[model samples]
Target chain A: MRFSVLILGNSSATPMYERHPTSQVVNHNEQLYLIDCGEGTQMQLTRYGIKSNRINHIFISHLHGDHYLGLVGLISSMHLMGRKTDLHLYGPAPLEEILALNFKYSETELRYNLIFHPTNPTETAVLFESKLLRVESFPLRHRIACTGFRFQEGERPAKLDIDKVAKLQIPPALINGIKWGLDFTDKDGKVHPSSELTTPAPLPRSYAYCSDTVRIPDYLPSIHRANLLYHESTFLHEMKDRAVETFHTTSFEAGEIAKEAEVGHLLLGHYSARYKTKELTLLLDEARSAFPHTDLSVEGKWYEVE
Target chain B: MRFSVLILGNSSATPMYERHPTSQVVNHNEQLYLIDCGEGTQMQLTRYGIKSNRINHIFISHLHGDHYLGLVGLISSMHLMGRKTDLHLYGPAPLEEILALNFKYSETELRYNLIFHPTNPTETAVLFESKLLRVESFPLRHRIACTGFRFQEGERPAKLDIDKVAKLQIPPALINGIKWGLDFTDKDGKVHPSSELTTPAPLPRSYAYCSDTVRIPDYLPSIHRANLLYHESTFLHEMKDRAVETFHTTSFEAGEIAKEAEVGHLLLGHYSARYKTKELTLLLDEARSAFPHTDLSVEGKWYEVE
Candidate 1:
């Protein structure tokens, strides 16, 4: 199974220099899911050669302009381009009214069915589910109602050992049981342990996204053991006071969260516009000091979840 | 006095390679006025090296997202940059509500005074006026309620004839009257003709912007004899039927309007996304076939009204 996250924008509220606001595309086995579409996101997607048509689902974390200002423009462009597939949108309840207002004023009749799945930021619960993956939302500490999403890969069935199954002369009726790790019996009344007939299943991978939030203890468990974790690092240690006042996290605090959660790798982003591009390395280094496996989330960069 | 127009975005609806949606800046005597802010207009202003702080007035033509979607993001950035100047916004009544909704959801209280001036699409009247310039709004045929703007220069002062005034011994109190073309009384108790005391005033220049509209005769008088005219040319001659259906103008129709209004020059823009940059020249040539002084409106180009 292929799972990767492509960073479209990583800057904070204001897009500075070549950096853009918060936006990303999560490619889960070729099914694209968009996370936090900021302004200029459609252009960024075009710059990165990502087709907007592949984005079947969109998840918004909050009502902040930096996170969701680009939604209406992207949706309008999609309708103009003659999109017909039903799009599933998950965000706060106000998002539906916001989108409806735009359409009402523009007199745009959408060519596709837009399905809105309103997400609650006050509680932790599963938001969406499929055969391979399940998405859950948890509360985040911010000035406004906000949410962090966690993608958990579903448990996989054991891989059948084809050669062992043939040699043991397994009946067709027991093939499903063998793949499910159940012991099988042959016509001669011979017992075959599931370990002899099948190989162990691979470890399922998971990813979590937390942004525009302060360091809070409640979010630690939801993002624990994620194969990859993306957390907002809006400031460094020097600006820790400013970060706290803005309901954002410092690089050190982000690293501490990553460490406490024991994630496979940490991706730090949502940098403040006050810092220059060259200064971003300081954030990455500070995060790495606490959690060694940390990297800066750069626009157009892709990180795979192992 | 200085008057110039800077093209920011010229695409009709969809933003394509190297072309953006409808947006332009009118610089009048060092003061910047924004017109029709579409998505990515802020970036376009940055690309053209225009400071956002200098824009104190913004005019949106209609409720179409391609016309005003970039407004909120630009406003937010200005606020973040510590802008305290009052912004005078002139557009349809719905525009104020759209901006208010964005700020409400984002929980952003402005740092500057935002004044809204509502425009009626059914009537032609002056929107704003100063001693040297006046801006008026007129109706345009569109799928929805739309307005076209006309920038009319006020009467110019006559050039002073210092030698004639000295030789005639004209009173200092009559200098203002002399520039305003009033006959002056000489110190010798003789009356000197106004023509001998001062040179005739130069012709006042004017410009008109008609976009997202079909060819209509009602808008002719408001734009008559404009020094420069920018009209929407969303399609080529072959797509006349489609243009009529979509409430857009083809290059030939745009040229015809310019020719009928006796404008000094014609600017054609709002190109369809179907045409590449290489093919834009064909639209210019077709418009020139009807009106010889037609030019294509490319982004970042400045056209002076002389």
Candidate 2:
């Protein structure tokens, strides 16, 4: 079971100093899920050798150009690459019309079905669910309507104790029930508890993505105690006034949010273009002051959720 | 007197092998004019140290995603960078609505005026004209409505013969008239014709961009005698059938067009992803076989129109 997040782009506002705008990939069980597809995202994916066709679900945090401008190009490329599978997109309600207008002007009839799911920024709700994963979106404070996403792994079945099963000679028919926490009875009518037959399941891992927003308390419960948390830090503590004016968060604010939510690890990203390559460490240092477990998000690097 | 074309991207349909979709910069008198704002164009401009603010005009050939998807992102970046100058955009009639919808959804009231000028692809006509430059658009045969752009230098003023002016002791005020082809009459009643007093102006240079189209004779006259001709060579001659079906040109066909138009030099680009880096030579060799003065368009290289 692999659960990790790969940073594709982390720069905020404009692409400068070889850093692109906000975009990343959440890899769970080898399946790729894209988040916040900023400009040049397709190129970033190509540069990192990520298979874009594998990305079935794409989540846009908002309608800001820095967060979702590359979406049209990426969809067009999927069509050109002969993709026949359905693509699921979740974002603000206006995104559906925006995409439709773009496609209408281009006169493109997509070969694959483009299924759009409009996200609600008014409340926290489940957006997607599969056999192993559950995705949720929650409200975020921003200049426009925006939402944050949380990916949580489904509960795993209890593992069978091979030695105990062999000694007891448990029938194959009862094995399934035993793993599901069902008790078994012997010929003598003595009940054998399922807890003794199997080991407890491992804890499920989760990751939360919050971007293009200022510090807010509305979504804290949704992202609580996530194994990994990626929060937008568009400015340093020195530029708190600018961050407030723009409805963006500072590095220290992101760290404070992670601390308040009690998340396992805080991943800082969406840095402003004003911070040079060497100056990024200052942002990291500022974030670390609030949360000691904070780490800077570097493009193309995978941070596993443990 | 500097007139050149810089290749920012040349890949057709999709971005692959580090080459982005169709985009290039036409520089005349140190003024940058963008042609075909493909995805990642702003990043491309920054990569080559080209000032994005210096580009006041942008011309998109068609509504294809690869041709104009980056337009919104570039425009947004300009706005974010605090641009106050007006931006002139020339493209299909529907493009204005598309941009308006994009800005509306993002709620972005641009800081600068975004002037939109619709182009007609059915007929060849001058799209823009300045004191030193003239840009014209002509129809191209494609699957959709497409146009090609030609950048030509305006007629230059005649150069004054310094030796003749000094020997004749011509007044400084008369020099301007003489340069404008006015005759100078001496007090003794002998007239000095402007042709004899001034040297003839050098030939004005021009560059033509024809892309995402199949071979056609409709616009040959518009690009005739261009100092540099950038023609799309999306496929090799071996894939002529595929080229014809897709309304794209093969290397041989592009070369044929250059030779038929009697252009000074042929710069071939818009290569298909099927051609690997080492295999691009086949396309170049095929085109060279038809036109000896053909050169492959390399990204970041400036081809002078001389």
Best-fitting candidate, scored by DockQ: 2
Tens-digit lDDT string for candidate 1 (A1-306): 689999999999877757888899998888899999998888888888988989988999999888998889899889999999999999988889888988998999999999999998889988889988898989999988899999888887789999888888888897887777899877889888888888898888999999989988998999999999999999998998898899999999999999999999999999998889998999999999999999999899999998
TM-scores, all models, native as reference: 0.91, 0.94
Please report, as a residue range, the 10-residue window in candidate 1 chain B with the lowest summed lDDT. Answer: B184-193
lDDT of 1 at B1: 75
Clashing pairs in 1: none
The superposed Cα distance between candidate 2 and the true structure at residue A241, in angstroms, equals: 1.7
Q: How accurate is candidate 1 locally (lDDT)?
A: 0.90
Candidate 1: segments with Cα more than 4 A from true spot: A157-199, B159-199
Highest TM-score: give the candidate number: 2
Give the worst 10-residue stretch by lDDT in candidate 2 chain A: A210-219
Per prediction, fnat is: 0.47, 0.79
Q: Report the C-alpha lDDT of model 1 over B172-286, residue by residue, as the tens digit.
A: 8988888988987756678887888788899999989999898889999989999999999999989999999999999998888899999999999999999999999989988
- Alpha-carbon runs more than 4 Å astray in model 2: A159-194, B159-198
